[model samples]
Target: MADRFHEGLRSQVAFVTHTRDYRSAEVLPSLARHGFTTTERPHDRETERLLAQFDPDLVVLAIDPRHDDDIALVRQVARACKAQIIVVAPGPHPHGLALALEAGADVCVRDTDGGEMFNAQLGAILRRKTSPIEQEAEDDGPSTITVRDLVLDFDRCQAVRNGESIPLTPTEFKILAYLAKNAGKVVSPVEILRAVQDYTYSEREAQEIVKVYIRRIRRKVELDPAEPSYIVNVRGFGYMLERRSNRRDAVRASEAA
Candidate 1:
């Protein structure tokens, strides 16, 4: 049964399992059926070796509670590898999921529904992996906008302000990058909703979600989030990037004068 499922997977995947019985009985056959390559490793050392060797695009971690510090293991693996991870656990716990997220598990699934839900979740993750946002700027060109000492590198998915890197979630980063790319332009909420979520503006409920994400982004990138200097709300319209500078820039300008 597992073998049949494994052969059908459209994307390349790497499976990691520590338990020998589970690996042989369940994991290997399923992975083979889904057309995913399986790499069985004992524990720490071999797991690390295989991860580096395979350099998998996605990692499916089958974790059991009895194993030695599974959470920590997951954390170590996630930190070391750039691949997106989907963790399968015995049961759902809010605290556990929170810990998993901190450890870098992009998605988590409970084993209650058996392997069926696991397979579905795996497929969903793969679908998302296939489509990534196309950057709106040139790779080597100067950024389209600079706001509050921050340089928006749309092509590279990076934001640097005063030599410090500000981490933004994929959605937050995209929203900011898009606004910055079209700087000095008052982009409407409708336009923002379409660009960021790829949803039609007519769905007002979905568009409202954009505001929530924008507020979260502002907290991270703005100096005074209450009076946002980087992402400015244009009253009834939407948002705009404000041009400001760090104190260091001001001091340097004064010295030059």
Candidate 2:
């Protein structure tokens, strides 16, 4: 019965990674047992052509975050196709996970989670993609949210600030749009993950992931990221976005006082 169930999924999965040992010894075997058709590559060389040929249901990326180019690889795969992405990193690195997700990865998995958990995560994502409700949601076209001069264009998955275009990954835009929709309110990291990522993490883990993305967002949006006037931290509570016009005015007022 289990074999039949696995066969029914008929999932086409691919792994793009430089770390071949872990993937070959563990992940690929597990995927095989689950009846998924699989492919593997050491890097994104000729990735577009291969991706188009495979037309996979999911793409797994195993990378070391310290290599700056790994993040770029994720962005490249994201632009290449609509396949859901899962990034597998070596260990418990929250910042790495945040970077992967922000670069358009659908989910980030730590390799320490082992093959069983990895297989389970992939299976869950496949189920969600095949879900009827999820399909309906994807059918809806993009929309826009205007928060003063910060305009979030969901169609293009980018932001425009005072007529200047700022490119953002889909996940980054979601986090920002969530904060904008609830402007002037403090939003906890856990709340943001639940609403945007559709998953829950421990408060500590969520904080680590959300803070990195917030810092990145500030760099792109704030005139002086070091002393931000737009997104403000609420101390031990959470973060809030101040929706006042001309945020520089607030900075000047504080400096004058």
Best by TM-score: 2
lDDT of 2 by residue, 1-257 (tens): 34544556666566455533455566777667656678877774677788888877677778876567888888888888777787888878887887876676777777787776677776655454333334445654446777768888755657899999986655566788888878888889899877776667779779877877787788888888877777777766677777875554533344210
- Model 2 residue 184 distance off true place after TM-score fit, in angstroms: 1.1
Kindly list the per-residue Cα lDDT of model 1 for residues 68-124, writing each as its tens digit.
Answer: 487777777876777767666655454454455445565555565456656655555
Clashes of 2: 0
The local distance difference test score of each candidate is 0.59, 0.71
**lDDT over C-alpha atoms for residue 188 of model 2:** 91
RMSD of 1: 10.5
Query: What's the distance in Å from true for residue 148, model 1?
Result: 8.6
Q: Among all windows of ten consecutive residues in candidate 1, which has the lowest summed lDDT? A: 248-257
44 Cα displacement, candidate 1 (Å):
3.5
Error of 1 at 74 (Å): 1.2
